[model samples]
Target: MILAALAALNVALAGPWPALAGSEDVVVEGAWARASVGTSRPGAAYMTLRNTGNEAVTLTGIMTPIAMMPEIHRSTTNDKGVSTMAPAGEITIAPGESVAMAPGGLHAMLMRLQEPMNEGESFPLTLTFSGGGKVIIEVPILKLGARGPEG
Candidate 1:
């Protein structure tokens, strides 16, 4: 009876366990967007995503009212020494880790923009987690030549 009581005490102290068993904690911070003026059909937005949840979260999609389509993208340097960008299917953020959407890395691609993205403007941005929860952020238009966060 004493052993059973001790076990019960331990379980209560630990509270309800995570549904996923052993999930780690991660968070997102310092999320912002970069402004762009381009003749192309699409423009890019940059930000940093920090994972502060108890489980790894995958960035599956984004919601933006300003653009027709918002997709995850990454920059890749080709053999010719030119940097090319493409769509990113998903991004995984480990517990206590972060994913940066900066220049020459992963970013958000806003396609079919209704209007030109100007500096000093704000837009609605919604990031969806794979598990279910979504984070809604207001992304301000940053300077076109501004550099993203370092580390």
Candidate 2:
């Protein structure tokens, strides 16, 4: 009886579990941001987004208090060897598809950083989806030049 009571209490305290990016239908993993130096105007955050649901979902927007503006961006190189970054509008993920955000590719551009994002620090980032699903996640700050999360 005591064990059962404890289990019930635990569930009650835990409340209803929300579906994060990488769980039931949508999964988000490997979320990390590049560390910023003094007075840096922008930073980048990378992550892998997976869609396990039956229907497609559009990643509508991102929000964070640490940056004045957060938007999806893509980096590309031209024939002249010049690289340019531009805003990427809504990104769609099909069923059983995974999208990777990495260096020189799609990334979350944090413009006008409110403060220096030092390494070893973590902050909250919210991702909004087209189906009214939102996921709040903590993004770890990695070294400025780190290539990926393993670094």
Candidate 3:
């Protein structure tokens, strides 16, 4: 009972983020998202993933309560400077390698958001890996179109 209460307190005070599973070999850093213009518009999240283990692992899925569907996506610009976003398949990280998700590049798409993602707010997201390892991260909502966590 005390442990449960402490856990609840931790979330309540720390943006409702779950503690990271220490056993997971993959580490997530600088997880954040942009504030949604409106509830009708989808939002995007970014982060950096580093593989600490000695083997390669594929990031297979993303799950979040704030959005009805979350997907992996990549953004590319044509020669004419028209950029398009498309679904990106699973991402693989080799041992001691790192992957970064940034705006106008690779990112996580939040479709059918439950509500507008406002600045100063945050949400939880779980990333699943091929070897059954999972990392639960809290993504803070930054200013609309913000580049990084500092903004």
Query: How displaced is residue 89 in candidate 1, in Å?
Result: 0.7
**Per-residue accuracy of model 2 over 1-151 as CA lDDT, tens digit each:** 9999999997785465344433347789999988888646798999999898887777989999999899999999999999999999989998999999999999999998898999999989888887456777899999888889997
- On TM-score, the stronger of 1 and 2 is 2
Please report how far candidate 1 places residue 46 from its true position, in Å: 1.3
Better of 2 and 3 by TM-score: 3
**Least lDDT summed over 10 consecutive residues: which range in candidate 1?**
17-26
- Residue pair clashes in candidate 1: 24-54, 25-53, 25-54, 26-51, 26-52, 26-53, 27-50, 27-51, 27-52, 28-50
Candidate 2 clashing pairs? Answer: 21-26, 21-27, 21-28, 22-27, 22-28
lDDT of each: 0.73, 0.86, 0.86
lDDT: which candidate is best? 3
Of the two candidates 1 and 2, the one with more favorable lDDT, higher being better, is: 2
Tell me model 2's lDDT, rounded to 2 decimals: 0.86
Where model 1 places Cα greater than 4 Å from the true spot, the runs are 1-26, 38-40, 149-151
| Order of candidate numbers by lDDT, starting with the best | 3, 2, 1
TM-score of each: 0.74, 0.82, 0.83
